[model samples]
Target: MSRLFPFHGGLKTVRHKTESNQQAIRPAPVPRRLVVPLRQHIGAIAKPLVQPGDRVLKGQMIGQAEGYISAAVHAPTSGVVTALDQRPVPHPSGLADWCVTVESDGEERWVERKPVDYHRLHPSELRNLLRNAGVVGLGGAAFPSAVKLNLSGHCDRLETLILNGAECEPWITCDDRLMRERAAGIVAGLHIIAHLLEPREVLIGIEDDKPEAIAAMTAACAGTGYQVRVVPTRYPSGSVKQLVKLLTGRETPVDGLPVDVGVQCFNVATAHTIHRAVDYGEPVISRVVTVTGQVRQPGNVEALLGTPFVELVELCGGYQDGVERLIMGGPMMGFALHGDEVPVTKATNCILAASAEQLTPDRPVMPCIRCGACVDVCPANLLPQQLYWHARAKEFDKAQDYHLFSCIECGCCSYVCPSRIPLVQYYRYAKNEIWAQEKEKQKAELARQRHQARLERLEREKQEREAKLRQKAPPRSEPAVAKPTLETAVARAKTSPAPTLETTAETVNRDG
Candidate 1:
């Protein structure tokens, strides 16, 4: 029996996962138009490669990774650039961001594909290739996969590499289905990651609810020396820290990452993408998304990134009558998006078209009565009530003092809140405000540094000019010496008359 490291607190919420997992995965039809966002993944937003009116082939690089931390963006279809402008994207704030609009040509044309033996190339080269391929964490964190592959910065030796297959979120069944259907691909991807990290042990954590996925993945890992461990069905177990703790019993520090504990994690989908990128030379053009909840027929779709949510909903037989909300993920952690026009990005795992009669009915938010319900259910073992108080009062620093960043925003607190305080929303607002303030401070500091540099440069230039003038200046001429001539003698005698006058005055006084 695998020794289980149980986490502090979690809920066994209603798992509405069967509705979507019952059907096999299908490819979402390429829409007529694609609104690809530039800043899909975490870190810097990708730099656009094509302007309006430019032609692009599917899988061709359209947006270059801004830096080492960013992932590249690609064209999902062969199309003409209709517009490069800001459009509404899938953000909690429902804000508009820069998007590359492409009008599809229906050709589905692909760029040249070149598979590489990653072992033959330098590790840095392989990472760069993944960056160009636009591979990132597909389990919704959307962190650049290539950046995580390197373990040298984290520790001297990696003891474990975990592949998170625990699709613990209630409505999100994308990872579960991926494991069941594409187990070999996921395992192959894990092998590639092992080559990069060379971890001592590899483990894939899946929840007990995914029996099919667990069996499929276990059989797939038969010869790979990787273990597929089924964890208890618990909400938020799929999260990085919790999953790591479940599998390895290691607690990532207060403000640290998984790597700090001699462990690293990758989403199973991310591993599959890495495999495809290295083995078949495929860029991350599409992903499997779960379209579940109150639709006529719900299922998972291998959707091209930038496919409209409306098209995806229609693919699932449109929203059922009396649909109240359209959420982007599970009802527990997901945010309710305003419209379906928001294109899917790497982070989109599930699109829940919720009906009025479904789970988590709209409840009136009331004042907190100092209840400890949120604290008991917090998986991170944080004091949710204190964090909520500080956040609601705009004491962001105090919230941080209570380890607010460690909260994971899992909504467990709000779920158990008797008063329906919307605790998670308050935490998110505090986090955003803190981030904005930090960004402003950074900008101000950068500007101050630049201005100081400019002043120093001007002063240096002025000093250099003065030094050059002194070097180029002519030497002063020596004072002309008076020749002992009549003119000089006369001038001297006139000037010396006062000395003779003193003697003459003395003689005149004697004569008187």
Candidate 2:
């Protein structure tokens, strides 16, 4: 065992996780309808496979992966496609996105299933299978798992594989419950990851708060030689970069990934899904989600993908009186969802029906007190005040200079701010501005390239036409000019010799 490395700064926030983790995970009843978003994952949106009125079976792929970084979408249950149009999705912006609405028939018929013999299959084939099965990072990023497994140009062999069981975000107990109940399945998935990456060591990093999870995972890993390293309970400890640094002493390069540091990470629930997809031929149709905070019965539920958040709230005995906001994910890093109508996607881990007290109370912004509390609690060791200044002033370049992207939007700075500044929101604005500017720059560059290519093509065509004309033109033989001597003139000049200049001009014009 190696010594654990410490991250720069973190907080000891409230752990509202116990309430949700106390109950056994229950299966959420299949909803009558599912609104499946095609662009749930963080890459190219999956192309729709079925049309309206088409009958789909449970586990059938409703959408196919369109690009390497995209994940396929499966039918959560047998149903008929009702609509393939824009609908309000669970996003911070309250925007509508493309979704497939399926009305379930209550039959729950499944498509044929064939489990893979992964040991005998080629690595590429295995990856494609996982893609079709629609595996993604269940830890909110929703990045396709196949892309991480490929590890192209990142490393030769992985040094470590860290499993993130540190559900540090308050009120999110899905992973915690998953670890305690399905430790064996999780370890089985770890074996699959080990076989794929062939890492030298496998480490599972769980927060010290989850003793039961740690013990269960420990017993499960006894014969496998994998380690269960209990990390100190801290806010944002579940973050991939922070966890990697804590467990392996390697800081992932800014703008890079864990793989760049010779390491890779996957959420524990993600690993369990991999095990199920390969061993049981099950696609990612359902996932465990935490339904807590201001609900009548707070706990975890294994809900099918596309199950409406409203239904989950109902399953938990409906919302309590005076519930103010509904947030997806946890309160710390999560975003406030517009309504409960949004359907669960791969990224849906927790649904927080927050009361006004449980939610971060809106406060009037005062001038920065310059108390430096944000600096002390920042997990990324960044200057929150400087970032706030630049972002507030719209000086995005300055914010970038201060390493704005390094800030993980952990809400620590905002949490500690005396003036109640929403620092994370400002940082998000700056990053979005930068990304938009970059995208415009790319579009302009592409247009320039196209124009340059057109100009070069025109020049080449002009040269080719000139060469063809030169080939067609007759070779000059000095125009057979006879000497002006008397005998030569009498013999050669019998007929009126055409004007050499005129004839040449005519020939050139004709060729032209």
Candidate 3:
């Protein structure tokens, strides 16, 4: 048994996990229409590869990875591309994004798959393969897994690799069910990751609430030298930084990644996708999602990417009465959706249909009592009250001084606030404003650079034109004759002198 370390400032919230994890994972039926978003992963949005009216096979790359930090987007099922246009996507802002709307042909046909042996392939090739396969962290961060696998500048050698099985969010149990049902597959995927990183030690972190998942993972890790460490059931323990601290006693830098601490963490679901991608030659076309809260049937479903949330709700026997809000993730960190029409993306892990009873009541906002409750429960060890003040005051720089970005927006602070202040919302607002300001600054800087370049280009062109004129003109023959000046004219008049009258009389006589 590996010893566990504790992180500071976490909440012991109610775990509504049993409501969803009781049942086995079910495969969701393909929807009649699938709306796939291209910007599912963290970096540049995948570039569209197909146009309207194109027939695509299931798992075919519909959007190719755009950059080193991007993941590909694929067809969820064999379908005809009906439209490549804007559609509502699963986001907190409830904004629409570019999507590939496909009308399923009901064929469910897949493209050719060629699995490779990881042992024989180079790490770069393996990372590239996973990148093309669209494998990202299904832990809800949805960061491209391929980018995490590369340890180039992060560290000389990886010390620890942690598989985060601690689905610590309330009412989210996709990872729990996945661990219970597909532990071996997850282990298989971890093997590939371990091969790539060659970490000194491999550890799997699970919360104490999940005994069955811990046992299942332990059994699967037998003879593999991987240790499954069960942490205390704490909200936000599943977060990378906290989990890293819990499993390895390493403090990830506030502005750096786990790799900066000689550790790297990935969600267990991400590992499973790696297994599927490398061993089965399949891409990330689907994921297991927890449909819980105010739902008729609360369970986990292996939902296809681009499948509408409504279809998964239907699969779970639809919504129960008093379903007040439809959220795309756990109540703690998830954002409420505008509607269920939005398609599931790589980042989606749960569909929470929260009823009034399941949700925190909308109490009137009151002034802060300075109770220090929020400060006590902030998992990131931040002064929540100060952050709230700064954020609410729109003092963004002060919020950054309070390490605003370090706050994971896990909602622990808000959950404990005595004033019922939506502290997290304020932080989010501040962060968004900061991001918007940063983007504007970047745009302004880019424009300035372009304008400077244009001015330089014009100056260079002007110089080139002058040089050409100088070269094209004929050379002066004899340093062209000088015009007679005042002094020269006076001198010439004196020299030409009195050839006048006397000379003129002699000249006239000769003429006569």
Better of 1 and 2 by TM-score: 2
lDDT of 2 at 187: 95
Per-residue lDDT over 287-360 for candidate 2, one digit per residue giving the tens place of the 0 to 100 score: 99999999999999999998999999999999999999999998989999888999999999999998988866
Clashing pairs in 1: none
- Per residue, candidate 3 scores C-alpha lDDT tens digits across 371-490 of 999988887889999998899889999999999999999999888877789999998899999999999999999999999999999798667755654554322211235664667656
**Residue 232 of candidate 3: its Cα lDDT?**
91
lDDT by candidate, in order shown: 0.89, 0.91, 0.91
Estimate, for each residue in 396-446, the C-alpha lDDT of model 1 and write its tens digit. Answer: 899999998887989898888888788888888899899999999999999
Candidate 1: where are CA atoms >4 Å away? 446-512
Specify the highest-TM-score model's number: 3
Clash list (residue pairs), candidate 2: none
Q: Roughly what TM-score does model 1 have, to 2 decimal places?
A: 0.88
Q: How well does model 3 score by local distance difference test?
A: 0.91
